[model samples]
Target: MKNLLLTFCLIISLTATAQRYSDQAYLQDRAEKFDLNEETQNIALLQIASDRNKAIKILSENGLLHPYEKKIRKDFEYRPLTDMHIVALSRYQEQFIYLTDKAVLSNAWAGKFYIDHGIQNPKGMAIGADFLTLVAGNSELRVFQNGQKIWNTSVNNLNPIALEYDKTTGHFLILTEDALYQLDLTLKTMEKVYDGSNLTAMCYYNDEIVLGTKDGIQSLNRKTFALNKSNQKLPWTEITSLKNIRGALWFGSTKGAFKLRSDGKYDYYASKRWLVDDHVVDLEKGPDDTVLVLTKEGMSKINFEPMTLAQKADYFQEIQRSRHIRYGFTTDLTLQTPGDLSTGYNHDTDNDGLWTSMYLAGELFRYAVTKSEDAKLNAYEAFEAMERLTSLPDLKGFPARSFERDGYEIGLHANGFSGEWYKKHVEENGRIWRLSDDEIWRWKSTTSSDESCGHFFVYALFAELAPDKAWRDRAIHQIKIEMDHIMDNNWYLVDWNGEPTAWGKWNPKYVNSFPTNVGDRRLNSTLILSFLQTAYHFTTDEKYKKAAEKLIRKYGYDENANRPATTIGFVEGEDLSDKWNHSDDEMYFLTMPGFVNYSFSEEQKTAHFNTVKSHWEVERSEKNPLWNYLFALSGSKNIDSEESAWWLREFPMDLIDWKVDNSHRKDLTKIEPNFRSQTYSEVLPGDERTLHLHNGAYRNNGGSDGNREYAPYIYLLPYWAGRYVDAISAPVPN
Candidate 1:
């Protein structure tokens, strides 16, 4: 008798725990009526009594509701339960939906409206008439109403890889690797739909279910289950990923990415030449229609905008204006100023210098938009500046080596002064110099023979943009000289002279010595391509084309070959020789050989167009947003692919943490004992960190005071990618 009593007690406790609410307590006290099905009536009665225990436990566990002590109250009398009542109760129980109005009649379930949250992992989610379902890694089918998971069920052998909804039958179709299953909620069972293929992803469109796999993409009628391969020519060797954005379907593979069109065709992007390291992990469309691509190496955002004829005409006028400035015309001082006479026509912080090279680039853009003579003349002036700058000294002597100026000595110690002085010295005289203190403690200048590629791009731009015979001849002459000065027997630019001078012995600047050489392949390719492109623009010279092709082939023209898959010898600020000292360096360098093949191709346009796309991806991830913008400017036909627009909209410059540290160095309190006997003090202050953006260019985290300002030119990115319009369009803040 005692054992029986204990069993009864245990049964009662279990029953109490299972109960969802108190039995119709509120209904008995209220005048309003509620009619529900037998099961829902029981649930409604329990819910009225405010059974906190059961509802709280279920909602919290399902990630539906936060735990709160607030009680829910509704005044309604009880009525007969029905099917609609059961469905209504189920829908109300979901966390995503909220009750705005009570059911008007007993047993009615159609009074509430539901809003949906944006889809998460939508590529694999199964859609149904009233619900969406997804299987987690644990093989549980979690049913969601309005983006809130209502319930879940555990099923074995159902490794669902893709999902689609059959609106006609209100059934959810699940695509597994081996078979397909159709789930019927009313029957509480799953039926075999179809079988026989390695399915990867699925989507529902226009009463058809689309399934993508390794073979190809196929469509099936939702009700009939009739399968038909899509007419589109999808190059899917291994369809590893898929996404649907704004009614468009995107497919990804080892080769590249493609978008499905309305007429059942595929448009390929970032294949062959244009994707940087093509192991795509994710693809998304932003709110502004920008395409965001995340890859194994980095992320890329693309914006495409179409160029209009009116815009082209405007660009031509700008090109004509630039030509006037280059040819020594007195223009508005605000926009174009002659080179400073005192500084020998060097570009300075005062914005008085013509910056002929920059203007040349602008001219090229005009020529590209509308082939004009003025643009060609401006381009020639740019080449002239390059020729003159090349004759300047490669190194200026301070306590340490610095950029040269004045053809004699280093410039005075001033912030943002060295680069300007160097520019002035090179522009005026055909000799590199350093400004220094003489025996009398007065400033003196000296000259040197070392050379650099500081202004080489000017010649390259002119070679491409120049239309007149004089401009073309001058550009060719300058190119040959610059090439002879920099290129070694191996075709790589030797960093410095090999002879000793009065100031110091000649030292070869290793690849790591200057930030500019970190990606030497890109620099060389840009220069070679510039020449080839210019030749193509002019006399259609096959020799130039062949030369460019040879260089690109030797380097590796494609995106994959240009990037190092592994993180070896890739340390920032380390000399190139030291970084690539290990065996892996050879492999990393080997990847760049695709450039050669791309450059040599005789086709007017080949897969090499993809190279721009690839570099944009790489640059985006490299913390250089400008390059991405530049790539879009040149490669994209429309602004739809630009990430810059989104950045401007969502993330403002004020949110960025910009810091600068300027502190004196204590370690340099005393000069070296050996050099103490020298006439001038050699002590230099500690490096300062600051942010400076001038002339539509920016530098972040600039190191040491002397070297605090760094332009993004080292990457050969947007500024040097030959997108003249985009380069000039960069907004300069007041």
Candidate 2:
């Protein structure tokens, strides 16, 4: 009996040793699979050693490798949108489309559905098919039409990574990491359809299952499970997504994308330059066979027509110049004599005021590509002409006038001048005026002179780009003056100097009041926060930090006070009586908290983060796409939540209500045709009959007038938030 016990103990010890080695082998295999070098491997091992479960989890969560265990661990169940399984759907005739990112079901029609994952819920629009399908993690399969239960009896233990309905066979082909399965929808059963291959992407083509694997494309007979042996030259690598576009098989892979002809030939398309990045996460065929490619950075529209080297070079040059203009580096905003009119189409209007000319010049410059010098010259001349207008000085600052014709000045138009000047001056200063103009307008208010945040922003940009430190210093000084002029004793800012002026249009209670006399706390809080944020970026000044924090806390950051909700429309003063200007207030305020939180103390950051998160949740739930997009771009952690994804995919619905009225003037009513210039109020769903509102926001030259302007700049926000890139530089966790 003692000898028997010893033998048993030995057996147990051997089993334990084998298990340990197995786990270690699994970890090493995954590390290599995910391209983790020795250094990352060591770090991962250390992380695993500290908490074997958590370390294993982090690695697997980051797609390093599939966990060794059969069941997913509880702690690492939640996946980011990037890692989630994506189900792209288009209806035959329905306007609403459905996107199932992992377990989240987002409808383009009804907005976002806040259904929990792993739960059996029959949500979203139902197709007339017998079997309902959904994607969960790597698995895509047919479930019961009413619930989350899998329908295929033979599909047990099969880990499906992708699925497509084979209309020809009346079945669904499921692509797993290892193999593929064909499920008979009518029979409610599945069979091992294909073997001896590692499948990646699958689609139905001409009543057959067109399978894309590591080897190549293989077509299976619809009736019989036998593979077609005659033709199999479909070249694909790491096929990520496959779509049937105009009868051709459009397959997007990690290496690039490809189109397989019905005749069995293939054309390779590298997405590195053609698309956003090498990793084409998804692809869909848009109008005219144009491919909508989604990548890690963003989405891009790719025209399949191959261009010559010269054409490519010209296209890239145009793109580069457009990018510069979009970032507000330079633009033409002036009318020049004897215009060549080669680059942009010119139209002369009766109201050829300075503001109009400046706006026209900017519009032309924004659209100009080949004739860049002409556009630049025209813009420079317009700025010079505007500067020749008569001088009028006010206590707060000089009024930015609207009309400038042959060197004559006109008083500022209320709503148009302030915002337009701010946008043009700060965002695109080089095009507006020369860097030397800073000294000329050093103390001037009127006389086509620079004042306000618009001028300050322009000067700042010029100083940053210019060679001279003196020019930069002068710009900074001008910014200081503008900051002082707007900020009141209570830390709130007055919009403008004139009584009930355009500046005070959004701040009605403080209308027509000097900075000292103004008492209203309006959307200027957001504007002031933006100014301080910009100032901090330029000078790294502690004063800007203090001002930003003060304004944030006083307005909506605290959450305890009955402060105005950032999601609501802005009405001037303390009056909640009038309907809020939802577009202007919300868009500005939505991004402000995130900006402030990035630079604030830990406690303050937490408060602002929570406030922004809460507001985002509400905005997302309400299907406000513009706000949702901003919230997502703001790096809201809750974006990874199932609820946020559902909302974001549906919020574009509100944009459909936008309309444009050409009759409405900036002075009479806030009407801007450019979708980029619109605030939340302008885009909000309401009965305010105004021209120039687009049913859906229009994207011009890959950029919009409003929040879309900041899309390119968003990449810098994460770095500014103090998140170190390398693990060694990160703060040690408690």
Candidate 3:
């Protein structure tokens, strides 16, 4: 009766508010209503208190809701902006002006404004003690009182490149590489202060004039034009810019940037961690408790505010709500070409069964923890999507990668899928995308074994956590169907093409074919044993237990599970060792539930625990919160929960697929490529330009020629799962 009323209300609402709109039209409603991009709108939605129906209703009325279609309700909220990536940052009065080669006026209390003023007309800025702004152009010096220019003088007449104004002497110091000149406010009287070969940058600190030269940093006495005794330590000779924050001295250089504390300790922030690029061009302390770092390529903002874990959870909750919602179900979203949230989701996303199952598992954890009605409904919705997948193409247990509205196909080129994949395909949608078929729907026929692992892993979670006896029984029954299909087909997912799908092989023949030196043979053995254990626990099926025992006794699957990946390196030119696969890492650890909770014997439990621990230890340096959360389950004393919280806190506020080029960066320490590595990072996971699926993430040093956004399950699974397992403490609501 309640659902009927809600459905009736939805019908009424759609009748009243609906109109004929194109997919592009779906992309642009919120900006017209509340004036923010989708990501920013999502962040604002998350900031509202969870139970604040009034605020939620207001956002709904204002058309600030995400997906542009989700109804405004107390539980329907999420966030997108977790980053403050920028081009340049400056301050005028209380305003934080961002400069992406243009003036972008930013305010916490007001909407931002932008103009292309002096976009190229800048070389130096001289700020007076009165807080007036003076911009040095190639041929002129323009002075501004507030944000408005007051006066201009001809710098071509002065023949100076660098400019600085002195507060104590009430004079201006104009500089070129060859000479430094002292001039009055009128620029009429000029006295040469210092003779130098090259002057790079300058700033006022400690009530003295500090000039950055090719030689080193030197302080000059303005009173007599004499050099002061300057014996301060520096990391590099060529300084770009300097700022004194409170009392600690901070400076940028050709090498990197660092700070000298009062207690004589040096704090460092190099690589992509704190720098957009390592050619540090300038530094400015901006309003709103932000320190600005500008480079030749881009700008970054460092907020002084501490983010609590509850806030972090709130952030990811909304991120999952907004970007990762997936038709209120789940699928691998097309991140290569981002969805505008206007036309909604792309019709051609792959791995629906796998991705949706993981999301469903995460929702299971969420429901178990909060018992929120929303979580239950969401879990049910996803289960409906996933459980129906096995039936989508008239197959009993073979799960397709995805199904799409008839005309959509993935990876289409001028000729179609390209190479052998192109079997008479052509480009559509303005030659940008490939298209095929003419019917109601088309499902990807070729599936992989990874999908199988994902499916069973999530199924186990659902069967264990489903709220009611009916839901539990349903989950168990479905698991039985898939498990039986695999067993009947001799341990493989037979695709629609009547061939074994790639990566779906699990017979002893295939599992044992992999060389023991590589990770796959051991990995497949571990996973199949886990699957058998999961099936047996739910159905009390003796066949499942016998199968697992056969693998252990005959194929040494138990010994296989105890093998650490580090102990046996991937050999070159073999089946493995091409590269370290983070996806494989995901699959291996995701299979851990059978080891921990499926009531395994002490021997099997110890073996699986060792496998989980070895993998987790090798991955500790990555500091991925999800990995850490899963690692804690092994009951290893080496768990690093503190880093887990830090990982959540460091998630970027901006979730857009902005170009993050790390090429030509100066601060990175490069390591030699090996089978154990994709790309080495001098910084932690939080410090990278973007987070992406581990498969292709390590190909380039930092960025790809193109980009894609990712699912928040990348965040949510680890966060909520961590909370459930007590690896991390749940935060109190602020």
Candidate that would win on lDDT: 3
Looking at model 1, report the run of 10 residues with the lowest lDDT sum: 24-33
Question: Which candidate number maximizes TM-score?
Answer: 3
C-alpha TM-score for every candidate? 0.33, 0.32, 0.68
> Which digits, one per residue and each the tens of the lDDT, describe model 2 over residues 492-511?
23322232222323232332
User: What is the C-alpha local distance difference test score of candidate 2?
Assistant: 0.37
| lDDT string, candidate 1, 1-734, tens digits | 01212322332333333211111111000001112222222221211101212222111111121112222122232222211122111222222222112221112236333323232222234434554543332255655665465655666656666555565777777777867777776686667777757776676666667776766667778677778655334534456556666677876655556666676545444321223334454454532344544343333344333332223224334433432342232122211221211222212221112233334544565565457676556555545444544343332211112322344232343224357675674575423223323322222123111112223334444444455657656665655554433333233333223323221111223222334324443333443454344334334556655655554555343322233322222445554424322112111111111222223443423444354445444334322323333333333332222333222121111111123221221111233333112111331111111323212121212322221112212111222222333322322222
Q: Candidate 3: lDDT over CA atoms? A: 0.57
- Please report the TM-score between candidate 2 and the true structure: 0.32
What are the per-residue Cα lDDT tens digits for candidate 3 across 225-324? 6788553355455777667655556677765566665655444444444554455555555335445554444344455554555555566667667756
TM-score of 1: 0.33
Which ranges in model 3 have alpha carbons more than 4 Å from their true place? Answer: 1-158, 165-174, 178-198, 205-285, 290-306, 331-344, 409-417, 421-439, 678-681, 694-708, 732-734
- lDDT of each candidate versus the true structure: 0.36, 0.37, 0.57
Ranking by TM-score: 3, 1, 2
Candidate 1 regions off by >4 Å? Answer: 1-154, 184-189, 205-208, 214-236, 253-256, 261-285, 292-734
